[model samples]
Target chain A: MENKTENNKMTDEERLELAAKLDKELDEFINSLPKKKYEDGWPEDRWEEEMEKHPFFMTKTPEPGAELHPLYEGLQKLKYDPEENEPEDLATSYKEDGNFNFKYKNYRLAILSYTEGIKAKCGNPDIEATLYNNRSAAHYFLGDYRSSLKDCEFALKMKPTHEKALSRAAQCCYECKKFDLAVEYCDKVLDIQKTHKSIIDLRRKCIQSLKLKERNDRKKNQEEKKKMSEEETFFEEILRCGVTIEGGLGGLSLEKLEPCFPQLAAHRVHFDENKHLVWPVVFLYPEYKIMDYIQEFNETQTFEEQLLQVFECSPEWDREKKYSPDSLNIYFENPKKKLGTVKLCDTLGMVLALKDYVVKGGTPSFILLVRNSPAENRFLENY
Target chain B: MDWKPRHEERSGTLPQPSQETVKNLKELLKFLQLGARLDLKALALESLLAMTGSEDGIKSVLCVEEILVSLVGLLEDNSEPIAKDSAACLINLSADIHGPTYLLNLSKNYCPPLQSSPDTIVKECLKHIFNKESNIADECCMILSNLSRDEHSVGLMFDLLKETQYGFDDIINIFTKVDYNTRGAKLNYLGPWLSNMTQDQRVREYILDPEKCVIQRLLPYTEYKESIVRRGGIIGTLRNCCFEVLSNQWLLSEEVDILPRLLLPLAGNEEFDDEDNDKLPLELQYLPEDKMREPDPDIRKMLIEAITQLCTEKQNRKYIRDKNAYVILRELHTWEKDAAVLTACENLVDILIRTEDEIGCDNLKEVDIPEDIAEKFQKLDV
Candidate 1:
């Protein structure tokens, strides 16, 4: 072909004839040189049988129904002499493979290769730390920052002065939002070499992030405390009132009722005994009441007089046609008065009468007058 | 005996009704007073309809209190022509801003002889819109369309639309009919009517079907050639629909294919000539060049908004990516001059790119960043 090209473009037919003549000559040369004796002039089948007896062919073909060797399955390779290779040399080879994989961005494969290098236990702390540090990088690129931190810790254990491991441990902690740990790791690196500007920058960043995180946590704690206090005040009011309101059977303790009224935080409530009858007892002056007249109480009439005044103004008087007793009027005026002309009703009876009056289409004011002993009265006066 | 105004010949000049003409118009109004013959009253209303056809004529007739009161009274006439002619006069009268308010006030004050309440006069006008009589229906729809311009009457008409169930189906039937002139008139009225009604959320529930497929029926009208009002109405309804996430998803879904339909209005005059144009839906394929370049920036802004809202959903973001929305939006962002539309295009592009980044489809080659930007970055590095 070179002669044809160099001879200033030979005719197409001459080139074809020369190519055919050379092909026949080449065939004759190949046929005459290849006839070799097989030591016994073996037939084709006999040649195959002889080839199978060779170690190369014997290993290539497995016997039928024979158990397969472990090396022939999966990735296992046959070892010529396993004891010849030192642990350190084997680990170095694995580390090189890991570095090659890492350069190509095959981070998962790099991680596996580095793990294999670490498991080899080469007894060289330098190589072990290098393996751990390399695997931490692979983990960092894969966004497994926690695992990266763990590998960095292992690297530091093997060689405490490993600068790359310390810097990477800080980076992983920072990525993981573990800012305090990040700052500590950066401080370790900075302490070893004061002029490490990158580590110092990282420490500054971590401190700034830590401060931001602390501020956020403080704000969150304050909001949570405000919510808790509001909830507590709501329950305390309900307990102090000892009355059931909109949330069913509200006289239950805070523990039982908190689940029902989760959103009803610190809202003032007024109880109407006729409206909610679940409570066994009703108090005339529940502490939860707003008590707008507390400062005026000393200048006004006594508590008994106030109670009689409310009873006289009750609409139940008009509906039931039950007039206030003449002796009740005298009780309102005198300091020492008892129920002589009127039959004294208990709290439940008075509540039922008020309810009955409301049911009869009359609005009534309810005031349960409790005749406390002198000691209880003196105790209430302090409030 | 002959109170009709003589037909004056002024050869191509608008009738500036003389004092004599106003006097004769007043005499015709007296004939339409209570207990007048139905035919005579219908005739008077038709004459008044013709007289009120000009701005000056409407001004002259509006000054005559008896004629305005009688025209509203004629709305409740037993004869359809009288009622329709009365509504037609009111519709023409309502072309001016004060006209609908004037008619609305008349409807409030004047009780027709047949209907006890004055408000029923407006209701009767709406009732005649659904009448099988085309003239009556056309005139009533036109009147209500004008009345709907006022915010108060729009609420009242929206309530009437709900009460009559004369909703999307009626509007679509009128719009899609073969008669172009009638469709134009009806859509001119129905568009603003529908656009105003969409402001009320309750009316929107009636506008959107239970299966949420009503937008599909409304999307085609966005391309109607004869009426820009109809297109505005459809785009306005779509803008309102995007206020909810479910409707936004429906708009972006393969079922509605709203992205391409929305692009129709925003596309420039260039014919879609790309080799890959076959990938577009058949409705979007080979559309008449400049078929949907809305001259109004407001309508164009609404189209951009509908697309932006659709991009809010993750699935819709993926759909927008598959449909090559980013390419169209990039072109629009460069070509668009309106500040609001440009902002919307930028926002939509940012959302699409951000979503693509989140999904790791960060093939920067697919995005069309200018080469000069890279050159600028190189200069900065140096």
Candidate 2:
């Protein structure tokens, strides 16, 4: 019984080993079968080459039945044959290219394509309008609002009631801050579709923006007017009390002088042409006329001697006295003479005595002299 | 004659309040509670805003249980002044260390997340931001900016940015209308918010949408003169954008022409010994001969960083090589005295030179050929 059991166990082990060997051989046989091929047995590079030669690709000509294919149809539409095709077809093809570029957000390239289409001179108004309207969108995307507005205008001229063109025109106008034009375009669009919510909302925005801009402009104008009036008042005040020294003395007239000094209205001041001096002048306190010292004053030594002589003849002359120039008061009738007290004294020594008397710190005194006055006593009293 | 009151006869100063007359927290809270008149509520809100001006006042105010929740509730008041004052008080309250977290919690509990259609309070704040009245708008912008500091709040802001009807564009429009100096201040906070929001890939994609064109909108602000901090913020946001590879390609695209825009702010005045001045970018060619150059070193460093990031792409590297960017960068690198700026310039020069070597160009010497002539030579080499 033990021998029989051992023999049976050995047979069981041999049966298991035979099954394992048989399964390995079956796997090897399956692995040896040929692998399924890709792209109909063609390698990747060769497949690409074969696809390029296919009738549906971007080529000059397509297969006859391939016209039904979308890509083939697109390529066929864009293939411009100068001899067989009309310029309108060429223009339309370029317009389609522009639309493709626009969809891809290549605004500059789309603009170029649209421009090329426009140059093709397609006579179809609808096609031309579509092209111009599409170009406006590209321009608007590029922030060239003015150019966009112009293209919209061109589109409108071709097709006055084109809804897309009008709506796009409104957007371009709004971007350019031409709110009135935007409103006008929106009105046109609303006329076509009264219940259009987007257009209605846009029109409302345009109106509100227009009102705000007008208010700002009106405020600016009022401020500008106020500034202009203030400047005018300043000039009027200067004319009333002061004279400009810019033109020299020759350009002076009584009409111009009357506003500054009403006293000069009655005086007949004459201009000496060669000497460039005012005539009919008097030097009352000095007891000498300006003509007497005019020639001598031009010479330095004679001018100094004449100044000393005039000082010695003063009413309260004192040779030993010291005076301060601050105490000396000199007055001229015409403040517009462009001359200081020292310059006037240097030119005419009639006021030289008063300069010395005052410089010595004497009691303050006035030396008033008039030009072209017939009065014998021209100097006003000190009081 | 009638006898005058003793307080009236005294000096112009007001008499000190008696203990009974002094305003307490309970009375202020009662004034803010429902059923109060609009004027009384506004007065209470104003007082709270003034009180929160001090750190101690903020601490004392935050201690009240429902006071902050009431303020957030009042943010939707129909009366503009009441809403404005409430927003202002909230802004002040947000200054404390725990202030933002507390307010953010209140917002989360009371207000809907910004991704879902905004709640009444969020809408009210946005309305005030775009309102014709600048003061109210300023307060709203400040409140929103403060709230944006928290990570959850930033996520909410990103959601708000996604809502097309009233989104980032509206925020940018309000920013554009703000006075330049104030806009700069507002940008200080908004810039960081923008940088944080852009970390999400979806947010970056949303910003780069052609309809939005956020990068183009920000480019012009870099040249703004009202505030360098504002310009710095804009540059910082742009730097954050460069972290994404796709954005770098878009920035260097022909439609964007970002190279000139990036370089113009860094171009020093003619006083510098830039021998390559003739190679200045096309956008800068029309600037008046005597115009002053950018004096800030921080702005220059930001510009260099933008350029360095842009050079990561081969297409961008070729464009920079064609534009003669190397000459300008070399000149700036040599002439720069600031240590940080010099380092940035050095990094840019290294990238530009390394890129040229990678493209098989061996000798890297200074070439002074005319731009048009150089174009011809480049075509031949290609």
Candidate 3:
């Protein structure tokens, strides 16, 4: 009964006190529940939601000890570091693979690696030079000299005085026997390091080899000259000694004479048989034995002379003399005595002898001799 | 060197059967007949070869058309000796006016033997024939020398000298006997052979050989009065050996320098003007309008064929490139109606199709051309 008036209508101070005690009780209760801890120390689905909302937050923020955000590191460091994110990892992997394969003899794989590294780096000249030089060596070993040379050229382009690259390039040029290029590369190498033995020695070898070749070539040419001269002399003797088969006067014209009567022109004599024309007396006496005469004939000398020698020949002499009294001798007016003439038959036997003689370097002068005619008007007359 | 001792002894012991020694009915018939049978082919070949070494053999070989036919056939034959014997015979024949016809026949059919013919003798014979008349035997020797490019054929090329009793100086006779005015038939068939051989591997080998005397023979030819033959021979020889020599570094460094020695003669040849003659000799001068210039159409037609042969030969074409191919092409483009120059123009066009588009007619500045003709040079755009 007393409760009716007790707290129901308590004063405002009593209500306030009660409310404060309730607030304190509520705060204590809220604080008292076991603290909710993330098992992985992150909010539930926090990363996933953050990635979807503003992915830049995770990417742009630097992880502890990551100098710059790993993703945002400049291209140069990304290419060098081994433990970066996907893109950076890819570049590092290529660089590592290139060096590894290059150390091995797997040049093709190394080239692939280096090329990938270059791609990853996007045309850095240092990387390009490495790729080119390594590939050049690979190509050189593969006997692809031209390709090797090309790569060396590229490598040289990047670092002009790269001695190893230059030496290798020169070696490739040498292997391809591109002496000119080899000398050029060697010169470049010498410019970098003036007394490199291998390079100097190679240049020396090239020079010596060139000199030896020149000397040997000169000697060979000399011998060739000697042989050619001998042949010329042999042909000359054939023209000189071979018999001249008389042809019809119409054939005596300059044109016909050149081909048919080569003997009239006195073609040069062969080296072996130039002895006969010491005197015209040799022609009249015919004292030289057939063998001796044959020795002067060079059958292989020319086609016409050989033709004459292979065919048969018969000699006919016509003598006519005209005594003009004013001329020295009026004693005998023999028509035959005036002009001395001899005719050669176109038979096979005589021609062969003449041919054989000419081939063997014999010059039978009677075929070419023309003298002692009163008017010097005698000419070959045969059809 | 001593490989044929037994054959030499046999030859000495036997009464050597003369070409005319056919006393039996069979022998007499073969001798009397112009053609030789299969049985007589050997005898005829022997006679022909014998004639090559001496003047007698030349006459003996010339008398037999049968031998000539056999030789021509042999030039095409798989049998090596067939060509070799024929070439030997041709060398003898070429020295005579009548012999040139036979040489021409052989030149028409000559080609290097197929690999099927293992005998190098045949290849050597082919080389000899080419050496005799490379100037005119362009196709014949080119085909044969191309065949002789193999390692085996190259090894046996010295057979050209089997009958070479004379030395290098003998080469002088090839030009010395005949004046520039001479025509119709060649006095020395070797002119063509030498010209042709210059394009051959065997000839190159001979030129490069330390022991052989072929270079000496070539020396006289270089100074020859007939500039065409001289230049043709020298340039052809250099062109043929270029690949081989250039491939060998040792060789390239040393011997490669001598190309100018040969090229100089060609330069001189281009300088030679036909002095005081309205008509240049077909063999001695380079006349673009020669065929059309002839009074007779038939002769002009023949000249056309000859000029075509002179320019289109593979070696010749290469020389043209080296000497003044582009300039000549330009000149030919502007010049009149010579069948040869026209065909050459077609060839030049084909060549342009393969040449790099960047290399234009401007490269021709190295060669000398008349200013009038120079204006006509084409810049072939490819």
Candidate 4:
């Protein structure tokens, strides 16, 4: 026989179980040995402690054939030898053992017995299907719906019209939250048995869940359509405002299309409740990276009005308090990639009307600088 | 002495401390503690950093537990220079193969015993790591990345991570949020650090737990763009977690739906027929002509390896086959320049193309892989 350590790969769970077993074995081995003393260091004996450096002194070494441990020689033993019994007889015996355990509520033991019966390769399809069907019940009782469903599939593969497997499979799908699949499985079982009470109740529960899900999904879909229509209106308004959106080429990369907040990113520009055109705008503070995002910047507000309200309190990162409404300058990158300054006093509509200004991804971003400070000059030199 | 070739070839040993420096290290200990002069603390930490720069110096420093304790205390200093240098020293110490045990078990053996502290060194590292304004946050992350690299220390480091307020969930949250650090600290190194932590079986259990909803959060980052270190680290973490061969079926199923995330990176601009496209996951469905394959060959190899691990079960192998994963691997095989990655691709393809009758097994895991061969397969690096 090959060494246990050779040609063997264990699962993570198996390895952990082995580790615990090894730890226990080692602890028992150590405890059985007599203690030996040794010095740790320094004054060395201010307080005493015992150290057992080696177990060899007190433990008995197993000589070839004459000790408590023999390190068993010969074939590694199997718990049950399949070669000794005929497949059908062995399988029937295992099934009887499984049923006895299942009757007594020893589900785990019943599963093991059923698994062994399945592995017996009994050749008889009825016995094989029964083995898988019973194992599926054991797994379901253990709250392992997925494994139960898997076994049910295996049973149905061998015996297509197995009523118990089909019903259990439907129940497993329901537990797994696959409402549509559960409904399909339920129909399959109904095709076999026209009216089963428990199956009928399960079908009703599943239909209710599907109905609730559909209602929620339809409500969500309606909100999305309404948002899309509003976004279409905002596109028309952009043309009315005469703002150029560079279409097709050299436009915003697809990255800008993924709207994070307020759901559909395409609707960054939309009409406000008051019939005013509202736009999402980004205020970039190049120095501190503390950006101010206004998701509903209406066309009536001037650059001065917004900056005044945002910077009224000296922002915490701006310790020297350089940025103020009057000193702030707004710059936008034109199509030719030149930084053109807009007057802070100019209304949001006038800035949108500027010949060189173009909106990308429905969001117009502007850089803010405290006009004549070093931070402003540094930000200007980059463009 | 025997003139041994193996020993001679292995001879790039680190610089040891001079006897005088080792003897006088106590003087530096005073400055390295919590309440020392700022400049003096900086100077002492700098000296300790120099000591940690070598394996021998680290060992000598380890002998003095009080100095190690001082280094832990100094990691919280208000001065960036001192705190950063203190973190640098810990990174060096933690990187040493022998250092994790000492760091974890510090003050346990001290003669005077130890004064109680509110936090362990790990707790302090995590506090600074989570605090955005802290300059040494990334440096503290580097210590964990360095510590967990050793097999012996992975468990110790995970234990330390458990003690901190920032858990694996919090750690993953901060890592995935691009540009989360406003102080210009990338914290991308957390990727590999996470990979290292997964060596512990418990960490894998926590991440793979279906109820935690943790593994799904990491799936999208298989394509994270900013830093390759982060990308590679995440891929490595995924590969390591896939070692739970028993969990492979659940991982590949809709519960986790990991196959597409693994395949998307390997697929390129190559076109597939409508029939083929219908079989593929939605993420891999039509070709975008500009689409690029994962650039790093090592990560490509890891992604492929993760798939191979998933392939061990019959259910997952069927999922991989049904999802048209072979088409992506076929395209990858043609374009792959790395020999290591191509071999891995070929191995995965070998399993996929065969009929159950030809393979003769219900589950490939039942076909045992020899321990020796499994070791060689794992060591294949692209």
Each model's DockQ?
0.00, 0.01, 0.01, 0.01
Model 1 misses residue B366 by how many Å?
Answer: 30
Question: Per-residue CA lDDT of candidate 1, range B94-190, in tens?
Answer: 6655565455545344433443443433565655555544456666666666666645555665655565545656665555454534422353566
Tens-digit lDDT track of model 4 for A206-323: 8667755654554455456557776555555567777666562343333333334443354556567876667778888998877777766778789888887788898888899888
Question: Local distance difference test, per candidate?
Answer: 0.60, 0.59, 0.43, 0.76
Q: Which ten-residue region of model 1 chain B has the weakest summed lDDT?
A: B1-10
Enumerate residue pairs that collide in model 2. A322-A360, A323-A359, A323-A360, A323-A361, A324-A359, A324-A361
Which residue pairs show backbone clashes in model 1? none
How far off is residue B152 in model 4, in Å?
2.7
Cα lDDT over the full model 2: 0.59
What is the per-residue lDDT of model 3 for residues B1-382, given as tens digits with 9 covering 90 to 100?
0000000011011223354532321232242222334456556566556645865545555454444544544554334454445554544454453343333333323222232222233343334333543322333344333322233322333343344453333443343334422222233434434434444454556556644334433443443444454344443444344334222232223223332233222221122232411122112233222113222222222222222233322333344344433433343345536554455446544553344343333222233566666455433211
lDDT of 4 by residue, B1-382 (tens): 0001010111123345567866678778667666677788778788888988987788888767677787777777778788888888888887776666677667543321233452666777788778878798788878768766755567667777676677887887787666677788889888888887777778889889976657877886898877798888888888888888778888887657788889989999887766897688766766566779999998999899888888877767888999999999999999999998999899899989987678878667677778887778666532
Which is the winner by lDDT between candidate 2 and candidate 4? 4
Docking class of 1: incorrect
The predictions' CA RMSDs to the true structure, in order, are 32.7, 29.4, 35.3, 34.9
DockQ of predicted candidate 3: 0.01
Q: How many clashing residue pairs appear in each of the predictions shown?
A: 0, 6, 78, 0
Model 4 native-contact share: 0.00
Recovered native contacts in candidate 3, as a fraction?
0.00
Q: lDDT, candidate 2, residue B165?
A: 57
Answer with 1 or 4, whichever has the higher TM-score: 4
